[model samples]
Target: MELTYLQTFREIVKWGSYTRAAEQLGYAQSSVTTQIQRLEASYGAVLFERYGRTMRLTMAGEALLPYASEMLRLHAESKEVVSKQSAGALTIGTIETLAAFFLPPYLQAYRRDYPEMKVNLQPGNEPFIIEAVKEGTMDVGLILDPPLADPELHTVVVRKEELVIAAHPDHRLGGLAAAQVRDLAGESLILTEEGCTYRAMLLRALKEEGVEHQLSYEFGNLEAIKQCVVYGLGVALLPRIVVEEELRNGRLKAVPFSHPSCEFYTQLIYSRKKWMSAAFRDFIALMRGGRGEASKMHE
Candidate 1:
């Protein structure tokens, strides 16, 4: 009956655990249970079932998810439609690399104008960011990945970013003009965590080429991987933007590795059905990096 209940219900569906949903929504577990109970009473159906250790949506819950999603979307739309456009809050989901290397300048510029705007930068994997954007929880999703296609969200290719192999300046591969897949045979590779898009592409290409690689170290942090590479630990595949400073300063060298599958881009994503507020429009326009748009945001 209450919009809060539906919001909580959808959060439960997203996380698949009462505790996790509660934590994410900033509600106590008991409060989450109570909201679900009230929602079930309103609908006269059991919404979830215990499945092993986690929760699974019941048939009734499954049927209600789309409706709940729609309700939330419309609720958000109405707020945007009626509220004064001051860019009150903008939530962005992105990966660590982009969060650290790519977005700071843009955030600084945007905040300079909309100093009162509440901006939440939620760092996450590509898939999670996409889903958050689709669900209307995140107002925008900024990611560095290959082209994405999804009916529920609008995708924009901001720019193509070269993927590079980063290595210590003194490493053996540092002298290569361009390192081919075969050139990396038997080399120790430091890589990002499993959910990384470029990491998957790199591994797959190596596998297809039947190039044997030594996985020396795995890390979730870009700086950690770069630091490891600087230690002569191993070469790491990362966005050129990420290693630009290190390469410029002689702390790291670009190994000149090129792979078609590893090609990626900086992209923007937003829900297709959600309303875009004036501030939201300005933010997107600003990200488009057009002279006209950049000028508008400052004005």
Candidate 2:
């Protein structure tokens, strides 16, 4: 009848060994064995059958799996809800691009506005961040444009950029004001690994144009790619915001082209069912107004 006993039964069946389940649960093996015994006695049915080192779930245990899992899930969800209602720590998810450039200033201004708010930022690409917010693991997410819409999530446009080709200072097309798509033919290029929305878009464009190039290197970190470019490795196509500092410092050059410039937009996304605190409202309002007003000054 005790929830802990049900939880232990589920864990024992899940792991298939009492010792392994004990290690996972941080309990002694004897303690784990006793817990299961108690559960079986209370339920008046054998829950597991031991075969050598492994424990197989009996019919009674198999029948109880779904209900036990749901009970734990509901308990966890209830705890999370209560915690959020009491202490207002907002967890925001974001992608590396936005986390690097956009978040710092906004976060600084936000902290000044609401000093009491505890804000946690979780960084991931569009898919990961969207799932976090959709599942209530994150309060909000600043992400690249996703391919599909989630009815549970509401998205507001944050900022947009025109993607440009970039090359090291020493590359032949480096100093040029702009280069045609064909100019990059057969050149060694740097790109991120797959699952990146922008990289996928760039690949699609390249295939459509029949441009031949060598993807000589791939990097998981943006900073490493920028450093590689500074060392005169190869060219890359990236959002301007990501390389603004390198561009300003003369370490890299943006190669404009007659080809269609890839347009990327950042979206402020959150679940429609989420309860926005005072801090959340202020942060959203600041992003919507601040990004545009700040850009006009650059023009």
Candidate 3:
């Protein structure tokens, strides 16, 4: 069957009227009717049933809807893939933290390695980045651990990041050399939005231990949260890498939790069904190099 006829059928089903579909497609209403007629004739069944001025799908059309939608989607994706390849673009998605601190030098090296390849980076939280990869919105993802039940997605733990509790230099908690997870009770705590994977894990730990604390402030922006902690508003639990500068400059004090240090796993995830392009492979290789190979490298 011709692809254009299937497209015409989709437009008619979407708009519910042949005239409206034709108007949207910039074709005559009679042309839309002819296409539907040709499609029905080829299948030997009526695809639509007239109801007043509108049309509804028949059993045959209903059965074919999913396949037709998938075919149209694949066709659109094919065009996109071709366009990206011709333009030498490689799209990578990750969270704001990594995109800000970790990925810059690596991306620069990637460009140095492949000057012809254009790199496109999209930054979001873990869930958003994972969904982008799954939906083919991104070609590759460097995300924090995504809780995916599907076995088709490959997740490789590139490194372990310690979740550190930080506070202002003169805060009461700063006097304690170390803190147990239970010691945070009755204190003001700053946190990220609930969609953050780390925030979810921290909240789960709090619930499990029944530790009660006042949530003084919450920010979707990590940098803003760090600034709040630095300014002595409240303590916050964040990945060590995120606040390394603050710690080094004595602007923030990191309180270690000994009993059960909340360690988060950072990963490079990509779709199993996706064919990794050459540019993507190069970028991944740069990330997985020896501990001291790159300036941002850490054990």
Question: Per lDDT, what order, best first?
Answer: 1, 3, 2
Candidate 1 local lDDT, residue 142:
92
- Measured against the true structure, the TM-scores of the candidates, in listed sequence, are 0.90, 0.69, 0.69
Where does candidate 2 stray beyond 4 Å? 1-87, 146-149, 257-261, 290-299
Per-residue lDDT for 126-233 in model 1, tens only?
999998787677889998888887888777777788887898888878888888888889889999998899899889999999999899999998889999999999
Task: Point out the higher-scoring one by TM-score: 1 or 2.
Answer: 1
Per-residue alpha-carbon lDDT of candidate 2 for residues 32-118, written as tens digits (9 for 90 to 100): 889988888888999899888899988998887767766765665465566644335678888787888878998898778777667
Candidate 1: residue 291 lDDT (0-100): 42
Residue pair clashes in candidate 2: none
Which residue pairs clash in candidate 3?
none
Task: Compare candidates 1 and 3 on lDDT and give the better one.
Answer: 1
Between the candidate structures 2 and 3, which one is better when assessed by TM-score? 2
Best by TM-score: 1
Quantify all predictions' global Cα lDDT against the true fold. 0.86, 0.75, 0.77
* Superposition TM-score, candidate 2 onto the true structure: 0.69
